[model samples]
Target: MEIELVNCECCGLKEDCTQDYISEVKAKFDGKWLCGLCSEAVSDEVKRGKKSSFGMDEAVKAHMSFCGKFKSNPAVKVADGMRQMLRRRSGDLSSSSSKKFMRSAST
Candidate 1:
């Protein structure tokens, strides 16, 4: 199967995160998946006085659900190098975009 190099659903980084990390985080949070960078950014923004937000958890959950569909598939064990490749091409996922992604993902 072809793996999509989407932005990490945790941190808003446009990196191509592995399906494993994405799935793990997604399942842990009710299907809301944040890109790795976005996830950290949200936490950091919160620390920087940004107001609290919602729907992130849902995005993570979606990511998890998406991954779950692939569980037991060989793609789940994709190499770390592939993730690095995605990261290299990833863009800066803004908090706003993160929210949008989450909202769209949930719907």
Candidate 2:
């Protein structure tokens, strides 16, 4: 039941988590702790690499490299964050409009 601060091995993002949760994450990622986003990215990489013989270690390394590039460039990270936010907002607007259009067409 102890809470500890864990730093993600990939992105270096620190998270406050219970000791049990930290142990679980480390166990899953080959004894390295990863934040939620990095873990998901690594999982996606593994799924995408299934046909190319990529293993968990390789996927983690690849994701670490990718995150390292952004970590060195603060401006790039900000720009990327803004871009993602806009893309998500736009997607929400589009989906709502599409639903309205479908309703109108049905009528």
Candidate 3:
């Protein structure tokens, strides 16, 4: 098999990749790999923080919060799943959450 050197779809960073690198998002995201810096940018945005032109934007974070909320409660699902798909397609949903949210969400 030819090894793949896909660029980090989040920000076009590149590296040798395998399936193990996919983020554990809402279980339906499909996109290319993300380098460390771009990944951080996306992560910050997903957490509902201020948008950084040097980093991810606030719009990205709000969209992720919307996805998270929808995933946690099917009855309260807002917007179609298409939003999530679009974000993933654009490689924009890779932001990491703060530990506080992670701890609570995992529980």
For each candidate in turn, the TM-score is 0.30, 0.68, 0.33
lDDT per residue for candidate 3 within 26-58, as digits (tens), equals 122334244554455466565545343432444
Number of clashing residue pairs in every model?
27, 0, 6
- Judging by lDDT, tell me the better candidate of 1 and 3: 1
Cα miss at 56, model 3 (Å)?
10
Q: Best by TM-score, which number?
A: 2
Model 1 agreement with the true structure over 1-107: per-residue lDDT tens digits: 33556654333335465678767766755565665444554445445543545354544444446545653422324445678767765644465678899999999
- Model 3 root-mean-square deviation: 19.7
- Between candidates 1 and 2, name the one with more favorable TM-score: 2
Work out how many backbone clashes candidate 3 has: 6
Ten residues in sequence with the least summed lDDT for candidate 3:
70-79
* Candidate 1 positional error at 35, Å: 2.0
Better of 1 and 2 by lDDT: 2
lDDT (CA) per prediction: 0.53, 0.86, 0.46
Scanning candidate 2 in windows of ten residues, the lowest lDDT window is 70-79
Among these predictions, the greatest lDDT belongs to 2
